[model samples]
Target chain A: MEQTTIRFTLNDRPITHAAMPYRTLLEVLRDDLGLTGSKEGCGTGDCGACTLLLDGKPVTSCLVLAAEADGRKVTTVEGLAKDGKLTPVQVAFIRYGGLQCGICTSGFIVAAHALLESNKTPSEADVRAAIGGNLCRCTGYDKIVRAILAAAYDEGELVDESASMPVMEKPLFTEGPM
Target chain B: MRSFKYYAATSWEDAVAMLSKNAAAQVIAGGSDLLGWIKDDLNGPGAPRADLLIDIRTIPNTSYVKFDAAGGLKLGALTPLVTVAESADVLKNYPGLAKSALSPASPAIRNVGSIAGNLMQRPRCWYLRGKDFACYKKGGDFCFAVTGENQYHAILEGELCYIVHPSDTAPALIALNASAKVVGPGGAKDVALDKFFIGPRTNVLKETVLEHNELLAEISVPAPAANWKSAFIKVTQRDVYDFAVVSVAVAGQIEGGVWKDGRVVLGGVAPTPYRATAAEDALKGQKIDEKSARNAGDLTLVKARPMSQNAYKVDIAKNLIARAVLSLASA
Candidate 1:
C-alpha cells in the first residue's frame, strides 16, 4: 500500500500521520487518533452519525478521505467544549432530553452547534432542515427540536422568577375569577 | 477497498498526463460516490482494480463558478454542488439548476460532491450495484430488471439495460443549454450536455461518451433570454436523502404571460436525460395556464414505454413536468 504523510489541525492541535490512500477520515479519527466520539452508523453518507466540522462546515467524515483532510482543520464532537464547560447545545440536549440510546447524540450536537453558530435564532423548519441529514430513531426528533430551540435562547431568558415560589403560598385563583 | 496509489494532480496538464499514462487509474473529485462503490466492491470479476486514484480536488483555478455576459456561466468540474446550489447568480438566472443541486441527497453529500462528479457518477440500479448479479450493465448477457425487481428502473429508454440515470443536475443543465469542456491527450473539445450521455444501446458498459483518458474540465451554460424563467421539481419517496423517482426540469421564456421557446427534460426515467422535444413544442406559444401545462405534460410522455413495475413513473413524470412548467410560467 502507498503511504503518505499528511499534516492537519485536529481539535486545535497540529498533528501529522502516515495514512494509506484508501483510509477514510472516520477511520483515522476513531482508530488512529482515538477520537471515537464520531460514530459510524452508516458507511455511506445517508446516516450522518460521523458528522464533523471541516473548516467550520459540517460534513460526513465517512465520505471524506483522509488525504482530503490534509492541510485542513477538523473539529470533532470531542472538541466542542472549551475550558471544561459544556456548550449550549450539549447542555440543552441534557435538559430537553434530546438523546436516547446516545448513538446519534454526538452528530446531532455537532450539527446543531454549527447551526447555532451561523444563526442563533433558527425557526423550527430551519432546525429541521439543518439536521435533515442526521437520523435519530429513538427520540423521534421532537425533543431534539425542543433542545435546539431552547439552545437558541440565552440561559437567563429561560428562567421564570414568578414560578420560583411554592404553589401553596400563592393564591389558588385570581380575585376576579369565579 | 482495494489498495491503490494516490496522486494529487496540481495542474490540468499534469492530471491529463497521469491519466493517459495509467490505464487503470481513476480520477476522484469529492469521492462521495466513488468511495461507496469501492467499498461495495462494484468492480466485477476480472476487472482491474483502480490501481491509482488521481485526486483532483487540490487543483487550483478549477473550483470556481464564474458568470459573464458573454459566457453566461462557467463552472469548473471540481466545483462543489453546494456552491452551485448556494450561488446567487445560479439562483437568479438558472433557478432550475440551483433547485436540482439542492433537491437530491443530504447536506453532507452536497457539501463535498462535485458537479462534474455528479454528472459522471454511475447508475444506482440495485442489480448493477449488487455483488451477486452480473447484469447487462456489468457486461453480463441478461438484464435482471426485465423479470426481477425493477421499481426504480428506467421507463423511457431501456434496451440492453434498465438502469436510470442517477443525476439531478444533468437534466437541469441540459434544459439550460449547457456544454461540457473535456480535455485529454488529443486536446480540448466542447460537447453539448445533451450529447454528453450515451444510451445503453450505444454502449452498455458506459453511461457517457467520455473515453478512458478524457477528463471533464468545466461546464458552460449559455445565457438565457430576457424573459427566461426556470423550475425543477423532483418526486422522491422521502423528503431528504433520496434519489428522484422522476424529476422534471423546465426552462423557457415567458413574455406577457405567454410561454415560448421552452425546454423540458426528464430524469430518473431514461438511460440519459430524456429531452421532451414534443412537449417543448407543445408548450411553445401557449398561454400560461394549468390546462395548457397539463396538455404539454401529456404530450411529453406520449411515447413512454414503461416497464411492468415502473408504470407509475410515467404519471409522476407527467405531473412533475406540468408542475414545473406551470410554476416557472407563473414566476
Candidate 2:
C-alpha cells in the first residue's frame, strides 16, 4: 500500500488532505475536511443524501472514492450560498416548507440547485427526474416539487408572490362524522 | 471501509499490467458498485477482497460514444450511463439500449455510473449482499432466498441460487445482439453478450465470465437493418428509481406484416438475462398482432417456476412481453 495525498477543488476552495485511498468522498468531506453539511443517510448509492456536484454534475459522493476526486471540482451543499445571502433554492425551500426532518434537505437542495443551473425552467417531470434518487421519509415530495417549480418561476423573472403551501394547514378531516 | 492502495491508470495496458501484477488489486471506473461491495464487507467465494483499487477513470479517451456506417456503434467502457441514455445517435439508432440505460436507479446515479460498470453491478439479493444471510451466492451451502423472502428472486433458472440478474442493460444489449470487448493480460477479445453472463448452474458465486484481471473495455452494437424494430419496457415497484420487477426487451425483423426473425430477453427473472428462445422461435413466422403477441408472451413464461411469493411476476412479465412486442410491431 502507498500513502496517497488527495488534492481537489472543494466548494471553490483548494483542499489538500491525506486520506486513505479506499475512503469515500463523503467520509473525507465530513471527517477530514471538517465539512459536515453532507450527511450520510445510506452508505450506498440508493440514497442521494450524500449527493455532491462533481464537475457540475450531481453524483452520490458516498460512492465516489476520495482518491478519484484529485484534480476535479467538487461542490457540496455548503457552497450553495454566496456573500452570506441565501440562494433561490434555499429561499424557496424555506418559503414552501419543502422539508420537515431536514436530514435529506441538503441533498435535495443541492440536486434542485444543480437542475436549475442546467435548465432555467424545468417541468414538474424534469424536477422529479432530477431528484428521483433522493429519499426523504418526512416530506411527501409534493412540497419539494412545488418549491423547485416555484424557484423556476422566480428565475423566469416573475415576482415570488403567492399563497404558497402553509406549513401545516391542510386538514385531513374537515368534520367529524356523526 | 478499509485502507487500500490506489493507482490512477493512464491507459488500458497500464491497468492490465497493474492488475496482473497485484492479485489483491481491482479495477474500478465509477466506484459505485465496487465501493458498495467493499463497504458492506461482501466477500464470499468469488467476491474476493480488494486490497488495492486501480482507478481507470483517469485513463484519457475512455469516455466516448462513436457511431459510423461500418462499425455501427462503439461505446467506451467509461462513458457515463447518462451520456449513453441521452446520445442522439443512440436514441436514433438503438432506442432499446438507450431506454435500458435510462431505466436504472436515477439521474444522479446514471450521471456517474459507467456503461461497463452497470453490467458488472452485483445482484441486489438480500441474502447475497447481507452479511447475516449465508446464501449460496456468498459461498454458503444453502440458499436462504429460496425459502426466505424471495419475492424478488429468480423464477426462471433457479438452479443452485435464485438470485435474479440485477442489470437492466444486459437484456436489452442481448436483444440488440451486442458484443463486448474484454482486455486482459492475455490481450483483448470479443464476447457476445449472450455468452458473457455465467448462470448459477455454472458458477453460483460469480456473475460474469471475466477473470480476476479482465476488464470489459467497450460494448459494440450492430446497426439495425432496414426493418428492424426494438423496444425495452420495465416494471418496477417504485415509479422512478428502483430495479425492475420484471422487464422485457424485444427486437425483431419485420417484413410483410410478419416477424421473420426476433429475439426476446427478460430481466429480473433468471440468474442471467433470460433469453426466451422458444418464444423467439414461436414468433418467427407469425403475423405479430395482439393475439399473436399474447401467445408469444405466454410461451415466453411457460417454463417459469415462480417462487412462493413472486407468482405475480409471471403475469407482469407476460403482459410486458406482449406490450413490448406489440409496440415493436407497430413501430
Candidate 3:
C-alpha cells in the first residue's frame, strides 16, 4: 500500500503525517506522534486499552485505520486534561484508586469522559453500560464504578433521588502522572 | 496484518468500478471487522487476503437511516450500529433490532460497526479464527471442533463444519423481514435477508451470497403492522460484550393473547440465521401461553442434532425461544 499524508484534528490540534494505509491509529499515535498515553493491551478490539474518541464517540483505536482518522477529530487520553487542572474523572480515579495494573485506566477515562459529556448525570446502570467496552481485570470493577460515580458526583452530574449518593473525599498523593 | 493498497472511493459507482477493476479488491465500510479479520489472518476457506481495499466510507450519502411510516425503514450500509440502536424511528417500530444492535461486543464496537458489516461478519469459530488450527472452515483437512472442544460449535446445522454465525443483528433483521440491496459490477439487486446468508452445506467459504466483486449497499425493512410486537432474547456466557450462545428474535401480530403468523429467527446455533419455521407453524392462530410457547420451542428444535459438548445449547435455545415468544406475547 502506498503511504499517504494523513491529516486530522488530534487533541484540539491539527496534525499531518505520512503513514501507510495498513497502519492503525494506535500504532501511529504511539510510534510516530509520541502520544503514548494510550496502551495496546490487545491489538484486537476485544480489549479496550487502545480506546479513543473519534468524533466524540468512543471507538477502539487499534481497529481504526490511520487513514480513517480520517480528516476528523481525534481525542486521546492526553487530551482529557486542560492546562494543569485534571478532570473530575481523573481526580476521582486518583482518590478512589480505581486501577490496579493501570493498563486499562486511560481507556476507561477516555470512555467515561465521553459518557459524562453526553449524559451529565448518569445512573449506575448508565455508567456500567457506557464503559462496558473497557476491560479492567485488576480492579474487579467495584472501585472503578465507585470512582466514576464519585467523579460524576463531584462534577455535579449525579442528581438522582432513588440511588445511593457517593460522597467525594480527598486522598493522599493526588499529584501523579497517569 | 498483511499490507494492502487503499483507495478512497468517492461514490458507489466509483467503488464498483474500483472493485471490478481489481480481482483481489474488497470494499471496507467500518473497518472494525475487516481489520480484525485481517489481523487474525482468517481468510475463510484459504481465500487470499485482499491486496487492495476500496474504502466506501469515503462515499458520501451512504451513512443515513431513512424511515417512512408506509414505505418502511431504509438504512445505508455505512450506518453505524450505534446509530441504529439509538435511532428513534427504529426503536419505535422495531425495538428488537435496536436491542440486537446494542447487544453486540459493547458500546465502543456498536458505535463504529456498520449495518452491512454486522451482517457480513464471519463465523466466530475458534479453530477458524486461530492461525494455528487451519480447520475446515479455513479449508484445512478436518474440522477441529468435531472431536475437540465442541462447546461453542453449532448444534443444528453442523454438516462438514460446526461453525455458528456470529451476527446478532442478522437474526433480528431476518425476523423483521429485512431485504438487502447489493451493488455489484453487473448492477444492483435486492436479496431477502434470510436468502442472503449461505450455510456450510451450500458453501463454507463465504457467509453471505455476495460475490467478491459485490458490496452490500443498503438494508430495507418493512414497517410493522397494527398490533405488532417484537422482542429479542440472547443467552450469552457473560452479562455484556459477549457473543450469543443461543439467541432468539420473535416478531408477530398478536391481539388479546392470541398470536397469528409470526417469524422466529435463531442465532448462534447454525452457520446462518436459522429460521424456526416449525415453531412459527405451530404458533399460528394459537394462544401464546407458557405451554404453547414451550411447545413452539420444542417444535423449533425437533430436528436439531446437537454436537457432543454443544448439546446444552439445545436446552438454552428452547428456553430462549419460549422466553422470547412469551415476552412479545405479554408485551
lDDT of 1 at B165: 94
Per-residue lDDT of B261 in model 2: 93
Over 4 Å off, model 1 = A155-178, B45-48
Kindly list the per-residue Cα lDDT of model 2 for residues B29-96, writing each as its tens digit: 88778888888887767677788888899999889999986778999999999999999999998898
List the candidates' TM-scores in order.
Answer: 0.94, 0.94, 0.95
User: How far off is residue A8 in model 3, in Å?
Assistant: 0.5
What level of docking quality does candidate 1 show?
A: medium
lDDT of 3 by residue, A1-178 (tens): 4697899999999999989998899999999999999999888898899999999999999999999997899999999888756788887786677898899999999988999899878998999988888899898887887778777776554233223335533432244432
TM-score, first chain, each model: 0.87, 0.86, 0.86
Put down candidate 3 lDDT per residue, B2-92, tens digits, no spaces: 8888899998889988877888787787887788878887564445578888999999999899999999999999999999999999999
DockQ of each: 0.61, 0.71, 0.67
- Fnat for model 2? 0.90
lDDT, residue B186, model 3: 75
Off by over 4 Å in 3: A156-178, B43-46
lDDT of each: 0.86, 0.87, 0.87
Clashing pairs in 3: none
Cα shift from native, residue A117, model 3 (Å): 0.5
